[model samples]
Target chain A: MGNENRIVNGLLKLHIALCLLFIFAPIAGSFVFSLNSDRFPSLPLGEFSTEWYRLIWEDPLVWQGFANTVVVGLTVAVIATLLGFGGAYTDFRYNFTGKSFYLALAMLPPTIPVVIMGLAMLAFLSRVNLSGTTISVIIAHGVMCSPFAMAIIRLRLSQMDPDLEAASWNMGGNQWQTLRYVIIPFAKPAIFAALFITMAVSFDEFAVAWFVSGLNETLPVKILGFLQGQVSPRINAIGSLAFLSSMTLIILAQLLLRSPEDKKS
Target chain B: MKVNAEMEQQSEAIVKFDNVVKRFGNFTAVEKADFEIGRGEFLAIMGSSGCGKTTTLRMLAGLEDPTEGAIYLDGEKVNGKATWDRDTPMVWQSLALFPFLTVQENVEFALKMRGVGKEERRQRAEKWLEKMQITEFANRNINQLSGGQKQRVALARALVTEPKILLLDEPLSALDAHLKVRMQAVLSNLQKDLGITFVYVTHSMSEAFSMADRVVIMSRGQIEQIGTPEEIYREPYNRFVAEFLGSANIFDSVITGPSGSDGWKVDFEGGETSLSKDELPNAVQGQAVTFIVSAENMQLSAPDSGQPGILASVAGEEFIGGTAMVFLETETGHELKVQKSHDELSLLNLHAGSKVIVHWAPESCHILPGENL
Candidate 1:
């Protein structure tokens, strides 16, 4: 029995390692090639160089795309987290008819096909004269990212004792005061986690931004432009940079998601 | 003079429920609750879960609005008043201490909501922290404190506002047996020292009887009886209260006729007994009645001793601290309980299946007043 268990465990570990390798190998290849002094990504021991990094660093278009992405990401994070917190608190505090329907609708956007969502958003934005701008990209990204924020915050709220809010009111805190003091403080960590995760989601989003943004293209759209015009190692460099930033945001969010007591220990 | 004093006491009631009824959808949570909590009285509302004890407390706290009638706080009709508008603070069963806040901050929260100045808030909160004997842990997070310390913090937080009345919902139900006793003392002393009316809701009889000056017993959304613990224990209002207390043996009987000049004769399933006229006033012959004999009043004798008692076999024994409870089953299948000291039990040489005679004096039996034929 012990030998059979050892064999099963060993096979499970190997399977997990293989899955991770398959997922990360392409990204690792891009990171490695972004530093090689080769025009083509054929890896036959080219000298390690920073040429692609310098090229992307000096490009005005690259700078514009990066700036737009940062602005859009931050604004989308704040907007989405506010909406998410409201949606989550409604689910937490009240039990009215059609509540389940409301929650299902709130959580329905992300599950929609991105292509269909992009098309619908483009149609809506164009009719409202909001398309072809950074604001349009942000609006589209916010619509897609709010559900992620809501899910994270909702999980945290479920862990709260239902009596905490009532206890606050019993102690003379009005509705708004209880929200500001009790509910918000208890959910502070999740709120921060939601912000970071939504920002990362917005940062990495491309399909919706591509459809809505005409001239004010975000980083991902600009990379697509680079890919179409020419196969360049600079795209690898930009991809590596974007991947690094998204990973950092996700890691920060994971840290915030840990209980405060866990941090002290 | 006594009438005038009684009127004054009635006017001094800190909280009053005036025929209040609360229903959620089709289910009635509280049914026509009419009671008054006097100034500085520690009143406990007790029942098993779903008995509306907590519902009654919640209605008083303004957390749940009564569907009918009104609630008054300190001579003011507080119907539809938000809980935040009332000065009634509650210590929750879950403690519900803010996990993110330090002990001092948790204590200061009520004052902060009331818009007290920063300096005064700190001073007042610190005073309560010291009063609760948790001043040293003031800066520590709530989760860092032990359960007893957290309980003290919860008390301190609720009391910082100096409300006229404090509500507690089984706040000690989570503690161990030893700690529960200690906290009971803490709460009892705190209520006396503060001299504020306290409305406590609990299902534990020991907690309610030990700490409360008066208790309101509820069952199935209705108040069974409200009296001092001793009064309710010695003379329960009905069969429900007797069974709920679980320390008395109840029997169904009917008044046969007058036993003598001053006593009436009654017949039960087990045997016949005589009750003094004072015990069953206005007794009608052939009217069904229910009476209870408390466990402590019962006696156990050897079956062969020719005692005038119900013959029974020992069912079991339960040890409760310094005393033991001997349970017996009569030949007619009526279960009876007798509480005695271990030494007394040892002298009787009782065990499971041992034949014994269960008997109680006629004066020891009290007829339930609420029973109807």
Candidate 2:
């Protein structure tokens, strides 16, 4: 039994190590390429250079794409968090007919194959003449990010002591006051988590952005365009930046979610 | 005392439920509740779970709106009004203390919402905390306090607003037995000192009996009986009330014939018992009625003593310190319970399977009309 347990433990560790290597290998390669002094990222101790970073920083399209991505991502984050919180609150707080069906419908966006969703969104946008706009990217990303936001908010709402809201109301506070003071305050970490996670998702989102962004290319769309055209160490530099920022935002979300909600004495 | 009585005579009902009915979707939560809460009364609505006891209190607190009728607060109709506008506060069983707020902030939440200045809210909360004997924990968060302390904080928070009526939804039900008893005394004393109307909802009969001035017993969304605790304990209006209030030994007794001008002879199993007809004014001959006697009222005896009582043998015994509940199986196999004090039970030494007779005075029985057993 002891020998078998040791073998299992060794195997588990090896599996986890292999998974981590698989995930980080691309990011490590991207980072190395981003710093290579040569054009192609040739090996044999290539001298490190900040030239690609300087070029990307100097490029107008890169700056424009970066700003566009931030704007769209923040907008999506706000809409997704608010809509998600409202949907979760209504779904959890009251009973109504068709609740299950409505919930299932709301959650169908992400599972419907992103390419199909992008194509459908693109078709809708073009028909409405709203294609290629920043709002279009924001709209597409908002639809995709909301279900995830609702899921996290719903999880937090479920863990919440529901009477806290009731108590606030019972204490002669109106619905808005209770929501402001009690429900929202208690759900702060979850809301923050949702915000950061959704923003990261919006920033990293590409296929829908590619279809709808047109001339308003988000960072990911710009990177895709660069790869399709003539990829350089500069594209690697952009990938590395994407990897760093998304990881940072996700880690911030995890920190917020894991923050001690129950205050110590 | 005389002046206080004269003033009390002029006091009106603080909260009134006028033909209120609350329904969620198609299921009714509070059905046809029409009761007036006196200006300074501690009224407890007691029932088993799903009896709408808490729902009734929620209606008064404005947490639930009546689907049919109106609720009045201080003589003003408040139908379809939100809970916050009702001016009635609640101390929930969960305490519902904000995990993010300190004890002071929790106690001052209503005041803050009412737009009270910070200094004034702090002073008022401090005063309430002092009154509740939780002054030391004013700055501490809810998680830091023990169960009793948290309950005190909840009480303080509820009282800080000085609302004329306070609704408590089984606030002490979450506490341990000993803490519950202590909190019961604390709640009663606080209610008395403040002279505020309290509508307490609880499922524990003893808790309701010990603290409430009037106990309203509910069953299946309907008010079964509403009366003072003494009246309820001694004179339950129906079988449901009798059985729900206490450990009652109820048997199916049939009205056989008239014993006298106001009495009827009842036959149960193969035995004859006479009950006062005055107590059963509408009892008809050949009609089935439930015979009820509280476990405390019935006495146990040795079967060989030749007593004129129901013949039975002890089936089980449960002793709770000073009192013992003796369960007896009659010859007809109907189970009857007899409660006796420790000293009284000691002489009989009735263990399991002991032969005995269950005896109670005919007047001690509370008879309720029955359709079926």
Candidate 3:
């Protein structure tokens, strides 16, 4: 039995190693490829060069795409976080008719196909004369990102004790004051997490942005257009850079919103 | 009982509940609760779970508003006033400290909300934390503190506001027994030192009896009785209050004879006794009543004593904490619990299945007028 247990432990260690390689191999490979002088994918490392990154940066179209991504990402992050927080607070604190229905509606956007949601929004916006505009793309991205924020914020709110809010009210804090001092501070971490995810989703969005972005070009759309015409070391460099930036933001967001429970020890 | 002019002129009770009714659909949480909390008085509302005691505290805290009637704070009608405007602070059961903030920050938030300057808030927070004996933890996160330490921080946080009244909802229920006793003393002294009116809610009889000047016993959304601890324990108004307070040997009785000046001669199946003054005072002749006698007041004797009172046979005996619980079965097959002090145990020397007589003085029998025997 002891020998069998040792064999199981050995297999478990091997399995973990394989899993780590499977996860990190692609990211490491991309980082290495972005520096390779060759434009084609190859295993042998070539002379490291930033020429690809420099070329991508100097491209006017690429810069325009980057600017579009920033605007769309920020707008979606702010709008989605606000909507998500409001939905979570309402679901947690009060009981009303059709509350479950409202919660399901809040979750519907992220669960449905992005193409379908984009098409529905495109149809609605066309009727309202809002199609083919930057505002339309921002709103569409916000819609797609909101459900993610709402789910995260709701989980955080549910874990918190309801009595905390009541305690604030009893301590002579009005409704707004309790929300400001108690609920907001306790939810800051989840709020930051929601913002990070929302920004990432809007920045990397393709399916929905391709439909409604008439004159506007988000980086993902612009990148797809460039890929259709050619493949290069520059594309790989931009992909590597985008992947790193998203990872850094997510890590920083999680740190900023660290749970006090984790630090008690 | 002496009333000073200033106190009398401060006719405004710190907290008052006047015919307030709160209902969650068909179930009534608090049914027309009429209560008044005096300034500087420590009052406890106690009951079993689902008895609406916590609901009553919530209504007073303005966390939950009553469906009917009004609440007043310091003579002003505050039924519609926000909790912050009422100036009543609550110490929550879970402590509910802001886990992300330092202990000092949690305590100072109230003062900051009231627009106190940062420097003054810091000084006040430190002083309160010192009084709570948790000054060392002022810079530590609340999650880092022990249960008792967190409790003290919660108290400091609530008290720093220095409101006219404070509401505590089972503040010490989560502490270990030793810590509970220690914090009870601290809280009792704190209330006395600060002169703040305390409206506490708890289910522990010892917690209520040890700290409260007055207690309101609730059952099923209605106030069963409200009195001092001694009065509620010794002279409970009904069988519920009597049994809720402590152990009692209730005898099924009836007023078979004529009424006396104080009460009447209540006759049980295997006993006859005169009722005390507080119970069944208006009992008419031949009126049915149930007499309740405390276990400590009962005397167990050998059957041959011929005391011309209740007679029973010893059912069993068990040595409980600091007391001998003698169980006796009366002639009608009713069991009675008699508590004998350790000093008195040597005199009785009780044994199970032995014949004995269970008797009490006429004054010890409280005859309650009720249908359920």
The i-RMS of every model, in angstroms, reads 1.4, 1.1, 1.7
Residues A1-265, candidate 1, lDDT per residue (tens digit)?
9999999999999999999999999999999999999899994959999999999999999999999999999999999999999999999999999999999999999999999999999999999999998899989999999999999999999999999999889888999999999899888889999999999999899999999999999999999999999999999899999999999999999999976444344
C-alpha local distance difference test of each model? 0.92, 0.87, 0.84
Better of 2 and 3 by DockQ: 2
Candidate 1's error at B248, in angstroms? 1.3
Angstrom error at residue A57, model 2: 2.9
Residue-level lDDT tens digits of model 3 in A117-175 = 88998899989999888899999999889988888888889989988887777766778
Clash pairs, candidate 3, are none
Evaluate model 2: give its TM-score.
Answer: 0.91
Candidates 1 and 3, the one with greater TM-score:
1
Give me the displacement of residue A32 in model 1, in angstroms: 1.4
Q: Please, what are the lDDT tens digits per residue for candidate 3 over residues B319-339?
A: 888988888887788888889
Residue B328 shift from truth in candidate 3, angstroms: 2.3
Tell me the lDDT of model 1 at B355: 92
Q: Estimate each model's TM-score.
A: 0.96, 0.91, 0.91
Considering only chain B, report the TM-score of each candidate against the true chain B: 0.95, 0.92, 0.92
Per-residue lDDT for B1-373 in model 1, tens only? Answer: 9979756756799888899898999999889899899999999999999999998888889899999988888878898999999999999999999887889999999999999999999999999999999999998987788889999999999999999899999999899999999999999999999999999999999999998999999998999999999999999999999999999999998889989888878888878887778866777899887888899999888878888888889999999999999888888888889999999899889989989888889899888898843
lDDT of 2 by residue, B30-83 (tens): 789988888989999999999999888887787777799887787678887888
